[model samples]
Target: MSRQKMLARALIVFALLGACGTGARLAAAGEFVAEARTIAELKAVFGQVESRTVVPARARIGGTIREIGISEGREVKEGEVIARVVDDKLTFELNAADAKIAALQSQLDNARTEFDRAQQLLARGIASQSRLDQAKTQFDVIVSQVAAAQADKAVIEQRTREGAILAPATGRVLTVPVTLGSVVLAGEEIARIASGQYYLRLSLPERHATEIKEGGTVLIGQRGLSPVASGGSAAARQARIAKVYPEIADGRVIADVEVADIGDYFVNERTLVWIPVGERKVIAIPPAAVTTRHGVDYVRVATPDGPLDVAVVLGETFQDGGGPRLEILTGLRPGDRIVMPDVAP
Candidate 1:
């Protein structure tokens, strides 16, 4: 064949292949469907809830527990006498000091009388100078004895007051470690009390803790509690981040959150808490629609004729609700149709 004819045949084959590719692309377009992006009020991603154990109150003095004023699970006020120590030795010492004080008072009275008599005798020249001096000295000695006795009595009284055990603060009694009439040593734990005001102490990953601040809000939920199955009603309680502990515990930052007036509801010894960060209202789509290609996040949006890949600015996830949806910060709107597999938008 001639060279011009051969070139003509090659050009015709290329044209046919191009037309076939166009037809295939057009057919794929017909299978795509549009999906409407709904605008629903979504909750922001809040942190997790935490709890700690309540410690018991200990006794300040050692003796037989004479009384137990509070029962388990009962509320107690500050400075309330939770127990009493029967220190018979302390009581005997107190009685002895009182007797000595009375004796010293009588002696002081006698000394003053003697001093008055000696002064009268000297003025009348009926007593010698040596006798008057001796009388005065005796009076002074008795006065000193009375002062010492009074000081001893005061010390005994103070110790007597300390024998009564008082409540450290207002809280609910959890356990009675000592029974009535049981011998207790000084500084021994007599009872455990849970402070009515509860705080959540927990440790979080170092990276997550950086996003938290003192006085921020925290959400609490029971551990092993699933939000999707229960609709997150139990996880709705709010808490204030009271403090962030300075040191890291278990490789995580320790934080304390104060539950807002919900202490009464949480009667259990242990519970969980959650803390939330930044949140807003935005368009959300299922995670399945999100596709990652070459380290970039893309979602297929339903177009009139077919699905088109659109780049999305992603926000926090709302995983608590039934549907696991990603908040769309940008690139989507309400009422925009989205196509599911095998359907046209």
Candidate 2:
């Protein structure tokens, strides 16, 4: 088929779409009354897929990364160990602490034996009171020394436990900056996780900022750079405005649209989105009432003289609960009756 024939057929199919309820065309009467109805004026804008919260898994102690259990795009749970860091010095220090504790424990044993013997002698009137007191002091000092060594060992053990890098949030890992054998310092990031729910981040023009609010409804267009149809099945997704940032930067207002099932979307991925800036009254008619000829759109009107075809300039098509309705920009007025053509046999 020729391009013109294809175009004509496509327009015919588009014209057959009719809204329901009050906006529905009176097919039996073969006429539709044009009236002004309030509709949301949508502004087409680009939105980026983003996570609500991005948390980074960080190392608590300085060490060389010994192993990494996660990579980019891997899912992780909160407090999950994603990597392990090893500090050879910490192991050595722990060993030294243990050895010191052992030595002090031996000394404590000897001091304890001496204190007991001194106490026994004192009780038998063989040792002076001062001698027993000195032995007791030595034993107590050795015991304290052992306890200090054990405390040092505990500190080392805690540092060793910090070597494991745990994920901060339960979500997909976005980036892993450090690899195996990479030397990292304490408080350094190991991996960045995209956590919580994903949403679309819209940077709309500052002019529409006042019109947007939390809990407002918006439409999602096609993914990527594909041109969005005026309003069609593919662009029928409706989302709620989760938040609107107060600050404006570079004449743009940032807002977040909460969309479920966007978790599979890549972070920073761009998609077209339609935001309702405000409401306006427009004359909408069903597609079945309009006809196209020679690349021009025409609608028949039932005038007092007879039915006459009037050329109409059409705007964006809007999808609502009724159906898809085409907005007539011009060539028609409110209270005008349109003649609906008979269905072809």
Candidate 3:
């Protein structure tokens, strides 16, 4: 071969080797990359909004409701009269008792006169001792009967006063089960009154009960209301866990959360409550970097050995003005290289 041909062949070989080296360098530089953040974390317990109903306070005595002092939805103080019962029989009994007392007084006056006369006759020896004793016994018996009648009258008056149903506590009237002039039976519910102090009862999964403690702080949010951003802009009421019901029902443990600042809203069984477990600071990454497969969560991290697969335990999601990020519970640390979606994996 000629020297010029040999030199051209050597040049072509060098060119091919240079191209292969460049391709390998590019391939080595290309790996998945992700931007991560360390975020302040908080745990929020979510609950549903609910309206509560007031229970009826029953009347102790049966009578016709002649007067209703308050209407439905009226706020009443303790011991305020809500309704009055019209009981003519009680009134008549009282009147008859008074008449009987007056009649007894006249008969006692006559008996006193006869007893005095009998005493005089016995002293003058014109009447026997037995006659004097008889007059005395008659007077004592009449006085006793009069006292009994008066006692019966007093009882009737007391019962008549009790026939007027009064508000047992300070609360708002939720319902009027009986109308004016309606006859209510004894111990019948006249109206339902709701106390201003409200309590939030929550049924949580039984497993969560182990983590909950009495007096723990609880955040109550109306369910259906828009989720609040992670800042202080949202309105959330706070409450304390007053008690934990010892029994479990329907696979949930019952807990009572007390909220003293009860507004003019009705609460029912559907109310939701959010209990705070605790707070911690953790490393966070974009949700896109994390992927789930076969019910296990994984993330690709850049390492000396190329893209490395990491299994991570996830914490709460933090959403702020800058958007949302996922908190990493484990298997991740600060300064770890995480894959960003735009980078080729």
Best lDDT among the predictions, by candidate number: 2
Residue 9, candidate 1: how far off, in angstroms?
53
Query: Candidate 1 lDDT, tens digit per residue, 1-345?
Result: 999999999999998787456434443542222233443232223333332445567776677888888888788887888888777788888889889888888888888888888889989999888888887898899889888888888887776677778777777787787788999888898887776455556567776766678988666654334565324533356667788987876778877777655453234434444455344456776665666778877766655764466787887555535466677777776765543332334
Candidate 2: pairs in clash: 15-287, 15-288
lDDT of each: 0.67, 0.85, 0.72
Q: TM-score of predicted model 1?
A: 0.60
**Which window of 10 residues has the lowest lDDT sum in candidate 3?**
225-234
Q: Which sections of candidate 3 miss by over 4 Å? A: 1-56, 222-238, 269-272, 276-345
**lDDT computed for candidate 2:** 0.85
Query: Comparing 2 and 3 by TM-score, which wins?
Result: 2
Ranking by lDDT: 2, 3, 1
**How high is each candidate's TM-score?**
0.60, 0.83, 0.64
Name model 1 segments beyond 4 Å from true: 1-60, 192-196, 215-218, 222-240, 264-345
lDDT of 2 at 215: 95
Task: Tell me the RMSD of model 1 versus the true structure.
Answer: 13.0
**What does each candidate score in C-alpha RMSD?**
13.0, 7.4, 11.6
- Which runs in model 2 stand beyond 4 Å of their true positions? 1-29, 229-234, 303-307
